[model samples]
Target: METQSMLVVPVGEETEFNVYVSTQWPTLIQEAVAETLDIQSSRVTCHVKRLGGAFGGKVIKTSILASITSVAAWKTNRAVRCVLERGEDMLITGGRHPVLGKYKVGFMTDGRIVAADFHYYANAGCFVDESVLISEKILLHLDNAYNIPNLRGFSVACRTNLPSNTAFRGFGVPQGVLVVENMINDVAMALGCPADQIREINMYTGPSVTHYKFEFSPDNLQRCWEECKLKSEYGIRREAVDQFNQHNRWKKRGISIIPIKYGIAFAEGFLNQAAALVHIYKDGSVLVSHGGTEMGQGIHTKMQQIASRELHIPTTKIYISETSTNTVPNTCPSAASFGTDANGMAVKNACEILYQRLEPIRLKNPTGSWESWVKEAFFEKISLSSTGFYRGHDLYMDWDKMKGQPYSYFTFGVCCSEVELDCLTGDYRTVRTDIVVDIGRSLNPSVDIGQIEGAFTQGLGLYTLEELKYSPTGLLYTRGPSQYKIPAVCDMPLQFNVYLLSDSNNPHAIYSSKGIGEPTLFLGSSIFFAIKDAVAAARSDSGLMGPFTFDSPATPERACLACSSPFIQKIPASQPGSFTAWALDI
Candidate 1:
């Protein structure tokens, strides 16, 4: 509690009180105390710096922290700093929900998936927060890159007293992808087929009308698989691994190729809008603003490219600022990978407006120079200001009906992971990872490549090693860096490769470039499937298990438990008293 929290001070009287420090927001603690209690919301202003590698941890909580700092400044008439310690951040904030999931898939004898049914139960921490949305998205992404005729998915939300689970890099896609990938592996092992043979039968071919009723091309998913397999010599390497595994006992090898067909918009309807402002200055400089948070994912950099392309100006001449609601009113949260797709579409639209205003001037003066045309247009159009909004595709559909193109387009990627596991210890290492993404067009090849690398690595962390742990009292015990482990640099694969399936003239976007953020992150489960294959190889020569469990963060301890026989365990780890409930029946 801050001591300076007072309404008024009389002219004749002296006021004295000690001011205690306030805590930061979204760092784990939900609410914030003012730096000075005397501060009023009306007189307060919030300040925000650049975002670091947030890993999707900053959201609703960050705003509350800013408000607290602003209040502290208002009351004390001095800037008060409240930096959050990692322990407090973790304890107060919700982590990923430990989900109990079941997946069953039926496919043709040739490996073409016919139908899929998935059941996902989420322990939605202490608060509802974003758990329901996550569950919905998992259901939506049941068929990551394959065409399934009949599919059914449902979720039950369980409320726990613990801190509410929130969004992460892969959001809900990884969970969904892993379930289906495991199902595929189960079938392949039963049918005695190589991973590639199964993929070739199931990979998307033509336009598909999904269960949600949108017509999309799944060719990129197959294209990514083809492009990456050829480059990485998947056939040759897989043979090498199989032969090598035959010779080795302690170190066994496994390889698999995965496809990701990620939806590039918010699952919720209300969050499907992005706003942008583009202004061409008098001296040929351009300023652009869009509603995509830059947690170091290159949202600003991408926006600059979009603005430059629209205005026919050099990218260097364009400047983008931090995403602020005040400047770009009624903007959507940058949660969706559509940072470049949605916001970039809006910025591109705004730049088109500015271009229209300047076109007449350019026509009259006949200036071949873009700078000159922009300068003339600015003077003629009364300052060259325009605002644009990305309201999804050109189609019109009822939101409640849930039957329109939710995303402008989909992003595609393929992850081929090779894992070597020690059947004794249940420890595994990613021997190789090959990835290819159809970014439509590469506005910046290096930037797009970096995005793919970062997203895939983050996905690896979620599936291979990162997860949240808590105690029974609904208190989060995995607080701070020590208990909460993420993938380290040394944990990376020995062989990593990336290929972009881009033609530079994407008819869909500013530069025909697609969003690459979450698409690459869903491969966490794909890689895990390969690891599961290795584990199954050691235990049984018969067939893969029905499902490999949501062994995400497939830690050595959990993997060992999954493979090693236990005492007839029937409890669900996500639910409290699940084991007890099972015992009562027994």
Candidate 2:
């Protein structure tokens, strides 16, 4: 309940509902709208040129809005467009789930977590939209990157009056990861050592199994931690932080390094399929249409690269079509950080089929240009169009048993954050952040790095700045930008460094590239731990020598109270069920 008063609401962009209905399934916007409106699917044509920014907000809600618009259009016999203002959008659309977690962990003196019992209650709003799946994800990811032997966890999707909470970047993984990280921090505080030491001691390096019984292969968990530690000079910085804390009374410095091993696939299992259509013209130009929608994640760019590489054609010669159900049927949402993995492989498959068709022609004329080869294939009446369907081959999960591989692979990364906290004001600034990620032969370093930076910054906002508030009667109070705070450029780390792991490749993915989206967002937990470290320093200065627990957003008020000895004294030691008191004794 410590975080209840923080009242931090999710600060996502206000995405408007925009759709055009025409007679169709191959078009982008019409199929889902048509189905929802109970109209002939072929009679509805949907055109989705592009999204402003979805971040998982537009997947289902857009369909809901489009259905409403279609009905209006049908009834009025005129065009209908519904756009919610910023305030209206905030009130109507769901954001990330507000989670409440209670956990008990038993760790050794060296800070190795041996067992954990955790329960997470997610505010699913008024409906069961994605909350059940989100809960499953939380349970699966409770261990984060650690290998805990005896762990039992479950989640409850509480129905509330608020709008239904939908998916964000990391889905529900961030909230789950936060709980385990907090426990690790508590353990470190209890053992009087750096949090990083405990993290390293318990990381999944060798053969390990999750609570759900999915086993891990030898992975880059240790590599990422060690590389981040060396690259960030964590040892040197810890010394500096200690010296700085000793010299300063009101301002304290703290550093923390956190690692993540996020699984890559849809938890639902059935949504792990994609289709792509490829067309090759006589002029050697190629067009690709895939089931995955592009919401500013560079998926199209990656697909283009995949097609170009697979066909041995220049990327400039490839054009990616807008996502439409007519082109690729029964598509999955572009989520779970599998946009590139699912769609890219489908495109690769389509291109490979084209290559096989043209192989005999190329063998006949060994030195022909690509255009000439395409014309020859046309003359030979070989099919120049191919549609590829790909279902993730080995993905299986028994939800009742909660035992199977839900993810095709796992993405690994580490983040080290340095923050300076002002005890007087509870204000904090990110001094610097160094990140080392295993992108597994990054398809495009620039695009992947941009995603890493953006996701990390958004996660930082979630943990430290953004706070959604509501009235007692269930009305949104922080409904607009003026009331909701998002991290700006000024809030960025004064110094930032990001690196992609080389010499690592995903054997299971197309071009051996791993997912780069959601994994890095979990890295933002480092900042939260860093803030906690500063608060711990302040408490140490005040001669309080046990673990300290502070809810997130770590607002100036919370930081000030965490540092105040008078505040600690005022808290009754005998108070039952007091988390603060319990933390002090732990």
Best by lDDT: 2
Of candidate 2, the 10-residue stretch with the lowest lDDT total is: 1-10
Off by over 4 Å in 1: 1-49, 67-78, 267-270, 360-381, 394-404, 504-506, 541-550, 560-586
lDDT of 2: 0.79
Residue 414 Cα positional deviation in candidate 1, in Å, after optimal superposition:
1.0
lDDT of 1 by residue, 380-476 (tens): 6555788998886553334356566655678887778888887667788888888878888776788878888877777777787776655554455
Give candidate 2 regions above 4 Å deviation. 1-32, 565-586
| Candidate 2, 1-586: lDDT as tens digits | 0000000011123212224321112233456555655655555534444556767666655556656666666555555656667787777767898888889989887777899999999999999877888898898898888888888997999998778888777888998889889988888888988888898888887788877788877468778888988999999999999999999988999899998889998866677788999999988999899877666778889999999889998999999768755677677777888878888888989989999999999999989899999999999999999998788756777869868888888889999999999887788999999999998888999999999999999889888887777765677778777998888898899999998877897897878899888888878878888988998998887888777667766666677788875555587656665533211210
Candidate 1's displacement at residue 573, Å, is 17
lDDT (CA) for every model shown?
Answer: 0.66, 0.79
TM-score of each: 0.82, 0.91
